[model samples]
Target: MSTQDPQPESTGSIRRVESSTAASGSSVEETPPSTETTESSSRQSLFAEEELSVLRLRWDEVQSGFVDDPRECVQKADGLVSDVVDRLTTGFSEARSRLEEQWARGEEGSTEDLRLALKRYREFFQRLLAL
Candidate 1:
């Protein structure tokens, strides 16, 4: 009997994978993300550049202190993680609140805008799940 792996399937604009079985070996093909997807992903940064820089600096300090004080380093790392999570939660909450306010004011967003918002949410949710 012969067995072969399932072929990769294309899904949306983010990923496209193709595979073929040949006499000698199998080959896989990857499709680059579309320009729109690339631009949107770049714009989806959760933190501003300055905020990210500060977080990276704090992380470096925590990592460097680990050899001298492991426990303190762990505690500091935990606190930093908590702060990042809180900031992300707050950002999402504020965005949702703004959308709710618009709806309450009878200001409906365009269908395309709403679709894009939902797509972003789904992508974020998927990334969280992956982590």
Candidate 2:
């Protein structure tokens, strides 16, 4: 009796691994381990590195000022969060507009490209839900 190694099947961003035991005619299906770092790096960021650094600096200032004026610190934090949300909303809108333009111009991207875009949207939606 021989056991075969699991074979990988990819469907868009998702992958499935399947293995079967010939003796008992049993099969198992599993999802492969996620490469979070690689995948996250590949996905587009809503903010630039410089923007993120500036935001971090501002956050640090707000935190440091909390000891002096707690109410003002809370207000600043609320404003910062609002700005971040606005920026994120604008970023997503811009991306969607670009894609829509391409489609309208008869330049619809490849199936894989569209699939990746949808995957990114799904990931963003999941994150928003978590919040």
Give TM-scores for every candidate, taking all chains together and pairing residue i with residue i: 0.64, 0.61
Tens-place lDDT digits, model 1, residues 49-118: 4555566777788878999999999999888777666666665666678789989999996664454456
lDDT of 2: 0.52
Best prediction by TM-score: 1
Which runs in model 1 stand beyond 4 Å of their true positions?
Answer: 1-44
Root mean square deviation (Cα) for candidate 1: 14.9
lDDT of 2 at 97: 83
How good is model 1 by TM-score?
A: 0.64
lDDT of 1 at 65: 99
Candidate 2: give the clashing pairs.
Answer: none
**In model 2, where is the ten-residue run with the lowest total lDDT?**
1-10
- Candidate 1, residue 69: Cα displacement in angstroms equals 1.3
Each prediction's RMSD to truth: 14.9, 14.5
